[model samples]
Target: MATCKSSSRTGLDSWQSRKSLSECLRHSLENKMFTDVTFKVGREQKCVQAHRLIVSIRSGVFEAMFYGPLAEQDEVVIPEVEHDIFEQFLRYLYTDDVTMDGASVMGLLYVSKKYDVKTLEQKCLAYLSSSMTPDNACVILEQAHVFDEQELKEKALSFILENGYGALKSSGVTDLCHECLVKIIQAEELEVDEQAVFEAVVAWSESACRKQNKDVTDENRRQVIGEVIKHVRFPLLDQKYFAKNVVPTNLLTDAEKVKILTHWICPNENVSPFNANKRTGIIRQEKIIIQRLAGLCGFGCSCSSGADHGIMFSVNQNASLQGFQLYGPYDRPTAHYDARAFITDPTTDDVIEGSSVTKSVSVAAGTTTYDVEFPRPLKLSKDKKYNLLVNINGPKSLYGKSDRSTVQDGSFVCSFFNCQKSKHSNKLNRYTDVDEGQIPGLMFLV
Candidate 1:
């Protein structure tokens, strides 16, 4: 009875064999083994050789070039693509793998598109999407426009909109072509203040003038910017700021400045040529009232100066924390208070960056809720504990309701914990499950 022992190494051997096959193909391409065709690539006219069969099987363009009416020519001239980029494109056809980075990704993308390699094109797009940041957003947007990649263009545009100030301030924006610049500035949902947009455009204009060998004068800047400057909503700029800063630039003629200033005084009159419609940056979606109290819960809940007061909670769904609603003083007229608000991580005892906002808040008459919005919405993840606190000057009366362990608003399930309070320390170290909490509700964009 010769019993054969089944070996577990069979699967490992098969995997190794498949990997070796890929490596062998890659080696053949790299060594230019049995090459039948040559390509004169790049402006320098570098001659590169490759196997026709492998490329023809991988790319429709190559297949057509080798077997179609153009099959007579054994040598292909690719004057537009760089030699290294062309080599990488051939390597992908052979090995189905490519090494991409910031510098080489765009070149590879161009080659992929020219060769009609759908898989490689998708990989390039994915790389662009994942590596996209404010500094490179404008560059990506310009390249996306050049390649006519609608999805990549939209993704880059959306990223710019969300981080408009950062993206526009990036030095890469100065190199954008006229069409790409116009497309960005003309977007209605661009989430940047008109003043910032004006400054950025002016900077871009100067750069454009320098590039064109023109003097960096107001006239030359304006000429370079051309229609792109028309998108700057001058009416949205503060009248005082515009008069002091914009008027000095001489970018706008006296008549244009007067029209904008006059439109500010008489808003009903549509005198300005630029679009006065406000840019819808981030839309507020939902306001979740954590504890619904009919009237002010004046159960000795007062927030004094240099004291942190709010609730610690976690949401079951993802949402952007736009702002928080605090209770105004009881039976008090419209009052203003200098306050500092914060969203902190309870577990790490660290405040979320860009989540702290110091502003003069106006609390309306009676026991109403005052909404204190953050500079920008802070994205909140699911199942993460966060503390929302506000430290206001003086011992102002606050409002809240009985302890609520959980609140269900629409599809969001927010579970509340003890109200966190810190008197002197920067960290929120004290916790109290009191009857009334200062933070009554949270505003979110789901």
Candidate 2:
């Protein structure tokens, strides 16, 4: 006797099979096909009818409530969970998917934990981690601390460290718990300078002190900062800043203030550097060339009307030419296409033989500032006038507004029409008439 081949072994695999089955079950859920239990949730007491077997299989709390001891009851109440969250939770049980925003994740995570649903709990944690921002990291850290989620808390803390200045400036930082604030200010690695860190701490303490209805005096603020003050690297602050801005403040004692000022001005004459408490970011330079915009150019598409615009600047030292910034609207599929950057000599009006950063474009919503970096740094010479030239094939893709009235004002800005080759004639290339006063946006850093 012949047997049919196993559908599980091929296109009809377990994943697809489960997806189709889940889709059918989800449709059934909407129609209330086999729902046998009703859940009355929130203060409004909204009613949600769901299949008992589906809920029992997906959740331990529901399984025990509907099968173990209270099998006879057909109606269940969940006043602790809001109706929107509960509905999404039930929808997940039937469809195997959950949609949530930052605000709702907390409540859903709580309900998921109460129901002993590990999958939803993990998803909630991941979402919270991804959603962390400079403005929200402090508040998210507080919530993570309350939930006892070590991983989420660490991620939030890292975000605050990376965006230390912004995080500290956020209004939410004032509402952050004392321990959370301490953890942030005490971090051993912050991307911002020590002075910015100190300012942020002082701001946060002032806000927190006011929130507690405490006076904003120096001694009060010192007490508010607590152990966090020890982490501030005062010696890293500018000497003048220390004398003018920090010394006048009553936050530090005379001796403590003297110690830091002395350490900065006369390091060997005083006590040793505060190495143990000092937090510093690892030294690394991005070596990116930041280009400021002169004017946006919007050329209409025509096969015969090819034009290119560029900005000219002189390099002061022997260095590598890397990349430049471009600003344009993100409207077309051509936005994904790679543009070109080339360098040329201002005196000779010839393309620098090997000076080109190729394939430097990164695709994004092209409407904002796009930093195009070269595959490798192209070498340049000191005292040499170089033009950072760019060309985009598509029309109206590269353009900016200009308010300058005369061609003489836009001297550094140049343009060429029908000059396809890098070695195009000097006669064909002339100072662009659009806006000379417009600051050249093209900047290159070695």
Candidate 3:
């Protein structure tokens, strides 16, 4: 989709026409019909010439940004673009366009790059370099790779490959990371072999293990990757998933169960020499899985009460990595869980209040998570902490109906609990039966 030239803003026309580079620039600039952009032109490889330009809404400030001529630059591509590309195109209007929005300048820079415009591309790259991020760096670096933008690609590769020989580790697989990796390992001669990369990963893993005095396995490596992913969250999980057929009688395999268990539990022993080798994640608190599979990531084994015992499982990975962790192990039966969540007022045995600890508050039970809203913008608050207390009703699809069927009966009968016993949180009232849209049978206990 990025490679295809088009504008994101609707209701605007693309600066179309397959005119040669010079023709487009001359026409766009002489008449000032599209004057809000910078243009670049240069010859290279003798026969293959170059003409680059930038179009952005914020080009003036960009051209005057850095000290002297900024060295590092990347390209932005907005095909058949609109005003969004206007600012970057404005930068290419001159050699040293520094005063621009470094953050929002990529797409237009890509456009300049597509036309083989060099100078403006360098300026944009410089802006990106001055203010680098794992996300953005990965992006422009990828642009460097695609267009053989050596200098820009190298700049991005340096950051990703830094932190003491981090070649083997899979960093975030963003569009930027994908491009940068391709560029960094473009040729075999300039690359470390896969075995070497493996060795590097092992070496790094071993170092981490020694520091923690823990066993590091292939599983451990995957876990580290998972941790990194938590910090650099993916905004793409909402992608539609094609359902796979499954047998109704199917139970989770040991390996699948373990994968789930470790993820939910993150069980680790403090290999730290000074501290006792205590299990890292076995606290007696319950948590709710509100995100992944809508609650499929949670795992619990219970054989309590009377006849047929059931194991409950749920998975929820909120946009943030905070509420996601491993659950109690399979070997352990009937475990207790207390997790971080937002629930009934922790203090009062009365009604639930609007100022609950949950990131999301909803008016209705059985609501799809997308419908819930965090009272404030979704952010973790250190002052007030809350948790979810769920009884394992077990094995339900997020929207019910397992892989075998569309309608599912296996959902949780969970409850929210407020653990905020602190002073600053006096305003929060206990959530209860009277709250708008509260369900009937479910009681909001004090």
Candidate 4:
């Protein structure tokens, strides 16, 4: 009984000792007690204090700097690192803890990497991953490239591609380096139209010209962009839009414009230098069949008055919405109808811009499926509810049964909710939920 009591007392003392040491170290760091080294940091050369032994013990780079054969100076100069950032780095060494947010995390990451502090570096990366958004992705990608952080670079690139429109529009895009900008424009998986890509490149060119101390003229803009402009996929741009918008600008040469026009006229001929291949995000479509219809029974939804009929659904992963598949007339072999499709954020009650497509569709005989495609792939974020509404002028069409609310296809999962309908005069101003509606499946690319 004496031996057991002694062992328990020893264990309790050890735990208390460890707790006391941690508190003492934290207090020492806070008070700058027994600090043996001084650092002149940042362009202003502000002085900061730290303990050499604690810093060396925590960081291999500091150990080498302080104890290696070249070790001599008690004072270190780091003109590139800010004073507050150095303080954060020293605090981590002393307390093994860090407080970071979006604004300070990047600086902390740079300092941690310089000092070979693996734990702090990883913590910074984890913070960045959680807080990444389209607005800052370009800036993050540029910094990741500078730091040679391959994993962070890839993550930033993926986020930019997934949210191409938002990222391109962000002011941070102009801050990207030339090589990084080229990589982004050349990516086949980028989910934005070629016109948007062109506009982003133009914006970058203007910024680059200003940095080079050159006038922001058409010639200077073209010169700054250089070879990056070749990746714009000029042939993929709409012919009318290209003629009206692109031709007016001096960015493209007469020869280049002629080549693009020739390709449009004779698409089979490889005359243009630019790639005509459609971005995979636009062409590689996958259909999520919420419910397949047999075309045996006519859908009961009223379609003659040109009322909008649709469904509300959300995707489990980031994707581009291509369009939707709706059924045609039940008995008629062929029919002509004016079809319009658009998507809206049901939460905000605002229609997503560039999502609306209107065209006259002719449903051929022997086919019940009518494909209505958007003018461009609409960007859809993961787990956000969007209403896909289509208005068709025709008679009764075939419909399907909705036995399940959720359907999983490979890496993609789509969940369907209530059907939505709106009259032509009100036209998406408001939607009334219908118990039964007629959208068969969603066409998309993940």
TM-score for all predictions? 0.60, 0.53, 0.27, 0.65
Candidate lDDT scores, in order, read 0.76, 0.64, 0.33, 0.77
User: Which candidate leads in TM-score?
Assistant: 4
For model 1 the TM-score comes to 0.60
- Per-residue lDDT tens digits of candidate 3, residues 244-313? 2111112223453344334334536221111112111112112333321222223323312111211111
Q: Write the per-residue lDDT of candidate 1 for residues 14-68, one digit (tens) a residue.
A: 4235657779677656656567888989999898888777888989888889888
Worst 10 residues of 1 by lDDT: 1-10
* Predicted structure 2: clash tally: 11
* Model 4 per-residue lDDT at 425: 28
Off by over 4 Å in 1: 1-19, 36-49, 63-80, 282-446
> Residue 164 in model 4: shift from native, Å?
2.8
Please list the residue runs of candidate 3 whose C-alpha ends up more than 4 Å from where it truly belongs after superposition: 1-79, 91-99, 114-117, 163-172, 176-446
Models sorted by lDDT, best on top: 4, 1, 2, 3
Whole-model alpha-carbon lDDT for candidate 4:
0.77
What's the C-alpha lDDT at position 268 in model 2? 65
